[model samples]
Each structure stands twice: as C-alpha cells, then as structure tokens.
Target: MDAAGLALVLATLRLSTPLGVAAMGELVGQRAGVLNIGIEGLMLVGAFGAFAVGVATGSVLLATGAAVGLGCLLAAIFAWFVLNQRADPIVTGTAVNLLALGGTGSAYRLLFPPERPIVSPPAVPDLVPGVGVFLLVAVLLVVAVAILLSRTRIGLEIRATGERAEAAHNEGIPVMRLRWACTLFGGACAGLAGAILVLWISQSFVEGMTAGRGFIALSLVLFGGYRPARIVAGALLFGGANALQFQLQAAGFEIPYALLLMTPYVLTLIVLALYAGRAHAPGDLARPFVART
Candidate 1:
C-alpha cells in the first residue's frame, strides 16, 4: 500500500478499536436479553475517570483501572434499577446517559476551571511507536468473545436467556444473574473502550469526548446481526468512513467541514435504514424478566 493507503488502513484499525470492543460487549449483553442504552454514559464516565486519575497519578495502569472501575460501578447501579426494580431498560439507560453527561461536564469544569488549561496525561505506552497496544488487545478480545458466545456452555445459556427467559429459567439457568453478569461485562468493555479512546487515540479527554460512538456501537451490534465477526466488520466500515473524512480534510478537499464531520453518522443512519428491519434481534430484547413462582 502507498503511504496514504497505509495511513488510512492504520487509522481505520485504530479508530475501530474502541467501537469493536464496545460492540462485542453489547452483543454479549443483548444476547443475554439486556439492552443497555447507557453505554454512552458508561463511556463518558470511564473517559473522565481515566483522565482524572491519569493526570493525578501519572500511571497509565492505574488510570485504566479507574476507568474500568467507574464503568463497572455505573453499570452495577443501572443493573439494580432495571434488573432488580424491573425498571424499563430504555428509561434507565436514558437516565444513565444524562447522569454521565451532566456529572462529567460538571466535574470537569470544577476540577479544571476555565482559567487553567488542561494538559493531556501520559498515554498508554505503545507497543510500536505508531501501533497501540490496545489494538492488539482489541483483536484478542474480539476472538475471545466470539469463542465465549459460540463454544461455551455459558454461551448457550445466554442465548437461551435471550430467546426465552422463562424457558431458560425452567431449564435451570439463573436468568437474572446471567443478565446482571453480562451487563457488568458490557460496562467493563465500555470502560476499557473509553480508556482506549483517551489514552490510545486522542491521548486526552475533552468534555463528551466519546461523542456518539456509544450509539454507533449499538447500531453496529444490530448491523452485524449479533455476530462477533460481522460486528467487527461493521466497526471497520464505520471507522473507515471516519478516517476518510479526516484524510479528506487533511488533503485539503473542497468539501464543507461540517459535511465531512458528519460522514460516519450519516453512514450509520444509512446502514441502519437499510438493515434495521431485516436484522432479527433476540426475542426477549429490552423486555424485563419476572420470575414466576
């Protein structure tokens, strides 16, 4: 590949890392019949946690840990509301998104006032100068998740839960417990994704740095038809659009900047419109499960 081609390829891989990771987690949760719309909020919280902890301690490991910790914490709360209280997943997810958005924005402004400029923290060390360690980790995670959902007995139970919670329950599967675990795992993946975005890609955190990637990840899961390999392909497709826009702007294309910036989202909408109805979601998706005596 030529220099531009190589650059585009690298950027595509780098950009897709987080989306692929997060989408895989979402796939797992959805397979287990929990649709977590709060993924955006989880990512936002994780990004802030990583930024704050990284700046305070200057340790990449600790910052990443903080990000995962915060993501899991928020996910746990969300699980309690939806899983335990039987709250609507959509409502709870929306609240989580709002909470993360306002909470992070407020915390950021308070911690670093407008007067003082924020500095980027030390990034996760790269495996090779240009290629990030997280890229490799993401690949491994995708493979692991694929195996987890396809080859394991637990995977069967998860699928069973999504298909029919009552039936799965009768079959001796701990439906609620499995959903809770999957939800937490999804949160952890989202947190790690946020860390990758800040520490690996942007190397800094901005208010709402995640933008709508969380939503994009959700779309990706649907676009991929809940399959791991297809999901990664979907992530790459969107990521390539993102990289293309950046390349166009850098090469001084005449396209309007606003138009260029919206490329990925526009593609997302188009893809969804084309495939949304065709894709078959889990039968029990977004439906709250109540155990029967």
Candidate 2:
C-alpha cells in the first residue's frame, strides 16, 4: 500500500484510541462484577468538559484532567445507584445517557451561542505527523494497561474484587472501595479519550459527540475476553473496518454509504452473538453485593 493508504489506516487507529482505552477500562470495571451501562453518557460529559476547559484554559492537560474528573464524578452517581442503592443498573445507566444528552446540548448552546450555524470554536491540534503519534500512544497505552491489569498486585486485587466481591470481602478485601476505585479509573480513561477527540479531531463540544463508542467499548471487554492484548486487537479490527470504509468512499466506489457507517456496529453485534456464552464474566456480574448471610 502507498503512504496515503498507510496514513489512512493509522489515522483510523488514532481515532479509535479513545474508544479502545475506554472499552478496556470498562472491561476492568465489568470484570469486577459491576454492570456500568452509562459509559456513553459519561463519555459525552467528558468530551464536553474537556473541550470547554481546553479552549478556555488553552491547556490540553487541564482540559483532560477536568474531563476525567467529570467522568469519575458521573460514574460515582452510577456506583451509588448500582452498588449502594441497589437500583437496576440498566435503568440508572439509561438515565445517565439521557441526562448527558440534554446537559451537553444545553451547555453547548448556553456557553457558546451559535452565529449563523457556527459556534465559538477553536481549531483541533494536530501532531506533526498526526497518525504516527496516535499510533505510538495507542501502543504504549495498551502495554501499560495490560501490565496494570494482569501483572500487578493491584490488578489482581481489582480482579478479585470484581469477580467475587463477597468472597473477596470474606477474605478481608475492601470490595466496595476497590470497585469504586476501578470505576473511577474507567471514568477517567473515558474522559481522557474525550479530551483527545476534542483537542485533536472534533475540536468542539457537540451534543452526543461520543456517539455510541462507549457502549461498543463495553461490549469489547467481553469480546476481548478481558485480555488487554485481545482488546487492542479487537479495537484495531473495528478501526480497520472503519478506515477501509472511509477509503472506499474516498475512492468513489459504487457502494451504499450507509453500510460503511454501520460496519463497526454490525461487527460488534456479530461478536456479541458469537462470544456471549463463552466469556467468563465476574461471578457477581450484575448482582449487587450487600450484607447477606
């Protein structure tokens, strides 16, 4: 393939980084027995928060930090409902997405009013060689997360807490605290992904800008069998499909454009159907652990 084709693939990988990170993070959270369904909404909030802070402060770091903070804050609410209040995680998660949609839409309008269909926007920053940088970062992050999830004591504790909280609790593990920590970590990753998108690609906060990548990421956890390396492969596969579609469109091939847009999702559904029963989820996957005899 030519350099242009290589670039296209690389760019697609970069674009998919945030989703990959968020998906892997969600995998960690879910592995511990918690069902967090509000990832999409959390991502939206993170995207908006990062963009608003980045533009105003002109510091990508600050914007990203704020986004992570917001993601964790939002996830806290989810943790409360599912972990403490013992509410239906699915319902609470839906509420989070709806809330994010309304909140982001309103915040964008109120903070940066439109003028002739244009809002006050800053340009997205590009790396000197955009695709190369994102690719390196993606690789490094995958390695780091893999080490964190599988090779460290904390990682083991995290898995222990998620897989069997009550059992871990009996063994003197702080199940609740460990769960909260992992969820917060997941949220932070989601927020960081948002910041990357806002600062490098989208450049502005839009209503529901995260699209449905959050949900896709959640599915990716199991599809990847909770393995960090596998998750990266999964991400690359999906991202490759997206990149190919873009190339096809640019090449002016005779094809229904809609198929390109839906390719990633269709792949996800297929993976879910094929792999759902094979993956070993946490023992208490969706069950709230309380003081039970």
The TM-scores of all predictions, comma-separated, are: 0.98, 0.91
lDDT per residue as tens, model 2, 161-184: 777777788888778887887778
The runs of at least 3 residues in candidate 1 whose Cα sits more than 4 Å from the true structure, single-residue gaps closed, are none
Point to the candidate with the largest lDDT.
Answer: 1
Question: What residue pairs are clashing in model 1?
Answer: none
TM-score of 2: 0.91
Report the alpha-carbon TM-score of model 1 versus the true structure. Answer: 0.98
lDDT of each: 0.91, 0.78
Question: What's the true lDDT of residue 127 in model 1?
Answer: 81
RMSD of each: 1.0, 2.2
In model 2, the Cα lDDT at residue 33 comes to 73
Please provide, for model 1 over 107-145, each residue's C-alpha lDDT reduced to its tens digit, 9 standing for 90 to 100. 999998879876776787778767888888899999999
